[model samples]
Target chain A: MKKDELKKKRIIWVIWLVILIISAYFVPFVLLRGINQVEASFLYWTVFAVAAILSTIKITTYWSD
Target chain B: MNSFYVYLALSIYVLIGFYIAYKSRQGMKQGVIEYFLDNRSTGGIVSALSYSATTYSAFMMIGLAGFTYSGGVGALGFELIYLAGLSLVAFFGPRFWLVGKKYGYVTPYEMLGDRFQNKWIAIISAGTACVFLIPYLSVQLMGIGYLMNGLSGGEIPYIVGVIIASILAISWAVIAGMRSVTWTDSLQSLIMIVVSVIILFYVIYTQLGGFVSFFGRLETEYSNFLSVPGPGFFNFQTFLGLTLPWFFFSISNPQVSQRLFIPKSLKAMKTMIKGFLIFGLVYTLVSVLWGFSAKLLFPGLQQADLATPTLLGSEHVPLLLGLIAMIGITAAAISTVDSIMLTLSSLIVRDLMQSRDEYSDKKQLRIGKFVIFIIAVIGIIFASQQLDLIATLSVTSSVGLMIVVPTIFGAFFWRGATAAGSLTSIILGAFTALYLQFGNLSPLGLAPGVWTLIITVVSFISVSLFTEAPKKKANEFLGYLDKELEDKNIL
Candidate 1:
């Protein structure tokens, strides 16, 4: 309930979102190109999606009221 | 695929929907709020399913599968980001709920009108939504038309498809308003995911030789599908352009944003968010896999959109499953179109027509019902035009809606946000998108969606600084909200 705590938590989320977007975008483009295996970008994105969902679950646990 | 089966199944589906609608109205309260919003008391499970049905549409199975059939892995990334964007609800949901409860706001635009202290803001936003959404709604009807006609080999006329969709959508929506829509949407959402997933595994196991060979075949045979810019359709810019507008889709699109107001409590909303995320992930994977199967089984088709229809009609899937999947796709389209109509009708009634203290709830609900019917007719006319470019039609619908995002974020986060900023963003942003789209011009080689977001956000901030902020109202509105959220630990 403290002002600083709310501000901190929100800032953490914003930063996480920025990092998530950057990784989801360029990392797959940069890291996974030319890897034709199903384990390439397909697997990368699956892991990426599951990771995003898990992170969201962690954040949502803090929701109350 | 006989026309008789399509006719018979649809008739039975309509009867079941109507029976559910009739039952939903058993002890319904009378008023705009009750009709439009289920008196803000929808339970978590129904809310979750209805929200899923409303947010997703025929696009997932038919359109998204086709996207994967052509574009490949990028489709999954594009859609998963939208799910990740559900994190936005974690921040915005509680805020919207608190304000709606406190102000008795019937629509998101009405809330914005009050927040910005300008009636014109509400009018412009509600109108802009219609400009984009009506065509989008028409696209859903066209999906039905194409599905029914395609499956029946044109024995069923296209007009019949549109009429059937309109009747079901309009009836489910008007029959018991949100309650009927929600109940029916719950059923439709289940059928959509269930039927599609079943068909997915059926194809994988029976035809493609199960998970190991199915995925192994894709790896060896269609390896281009495993990475970015696959097959030259989803280059980086194209991916961002498509996903960016859709990422904001949750709050910018009024139909979904209004769902933020329907859950009876914060706990219910938490459930809604969790349910939608899991449903969305599973459905996205299902559609993508369906597309991959299509690519592997029936390659070299002239059109990517043919992937779904081709698969459904193939000898691989059983006739009964194929028929049920067709009905599931129809259900998906109807659920989406009806939700849009109900929200747009509320917007027209509350924001555009009625003076705040002048109209009674009975009169408003009466006009609301009438507006819904007219909206359905206009939808029929639009669908009759037959705009068939799937990617263009899909992305274009979200472009104008994206114009509202900055104003929304500014309203909630920055107290300096003003009505002038909201108007400038909506008007100029829409103009930019329309010009770029019609002229086939994307300055700097960026997409219209990317440009619209940039212009709208820049304009909103710049315009708000020059205009006067409604200081007292902002304080009273936001001051109360911050404290309430803090007390509740919502952040």
Candidate 2:
């Protein structure tokens, strides 16, 4: 891999990251509906808990040295 | 017995922390790296405790009680998983330490940039971090004002308390950077743990007669306090959405990453993890007890955030009550606010504006302090508005971080992911987060963040596959990682 190619790839990777962030604007709307406030809050936490656990796994497996 | 004393005691704590920072400035390096990251020489206990204190702040007081008040015992269930997050950190901390130490990595952005060799990754990351962290710090200040006024019988105006607390937070946090915040956080953690335990015991022994008696009383007064809410709390999309993004967030968030950068050894990392696990469990139990006890003591109350303080006031013990009211909240607000300020300063200086040329550490420290001052002012303005602490933090941080997850993960694990793919995923995810957070429109009656995460994952994968990946880019980024981690035998 040449230096130019590497820089270009880096730019592309960043662009991809931005797309993911923009997509997040729609997450809560999709999951929270027809639920009571208590139920909704609980569900929000449940997703957070699961996500924390999964991120932990991903960090362990893939975080490069 | 008034808010004056609470303010006085908090002032003393701030002074001690600032003194530590002033003294340590002599031993620090003359570069931005050393001032902000402390040259990665932090020990296990300090790193672990600091991380815990930063993560568990005023929100625990203002928000958690309100949650329990509104949701019953189900609120406790949320914190139950916090231990799992700590354990994950414990396991990951050692590895991160090894890499950070070997490569001289200072900020979370450094890790992403080094891994992907992408400058935009670092820039966007730092931007997202500041957006969330600055507002989050404001919430802590608001908590302090709320606590001081409540304890002082409304003697201290909320604005005055906010001003005093904000000024101190910036002083210690800006001066010492991580060096000061870490030590202050350690002491704050000790105070919080000791005071919480003491209060818990006092309530058990005096209020309810004993631990056993308290348990018995709880059964009679609020038996459902210990039980989980029924399937009403369990919707498929909601549950998954709430829990799944956290997995992405834990690994992706810069604040957590910054903690992992410290730790003197693998053993120190392990101990810190173990300590937080214990603390997390105990903290959850105590908070739940405190919250439910509020319901038992105050039969008719609309605002749940006041439950703990109200319970303390009911006991008729002035000094102990004042201490609980003052220190309980001081522990949460000061510890959290300072860390956020320090973290924000680091992001701006170390991550965003880092110069390639050799620079004096003193000069960088001065610049960092200036940034802290600006952030403190912004926070004061933000907190003056009435907003729920948890909502404020979630709006500012969680959604943005949730979007960053897939791209961060891909950068580390997926060789096929492209630069374009990373940017698109981040933009989409952030937009989705904002939409879910405040939008009027919805699809299938589900929250937008969930849809955001789902789409982010799919888009990231789909884009990587369909588009031609930077052929030489993968090897180059991997090459950088190999060089950075290889010397320490980390890879």
The best candidate in terms of TM-score: 1
| Per-residue C-alpha lDDT of model 1 across residues B287-334, encoded as one tens digit per residue | 999999999999998899889999998898888888899988999899
Q: Chain A TM-score, candidate 2? A: 0.41
What fraction of the real A-B contacts shows up in model 1? 0.66
Ten-residue segment with the worst summed lDDT in candidate 2 chain A?
Answer: A20-29
What candidate 2 gets wrong by more than 4 Å, as runs, is A1-65, B23-26, B90-95, B230-242, B245-249, B354-363, B387-396, B440-442, B468-491
TM-score per candidate = 0.98, 0.81
Candidate 1 off by > 4 Å: B354-356, B387-394
Please tell me which predicted candidate would have the highest lDDT against the true structure: 1
Error in Å for residue B172 of model 2: 1.6
> For each candidate, C-alpha RMSD in Å?
1.4, 7.8
Tens-digit lDDT track for model 2 on B257-359?
6777766655565556656655665666677666655666676776777777777666533575556556766766877887777777777776687473355
Error of 2 at B251 (Å): 2.7
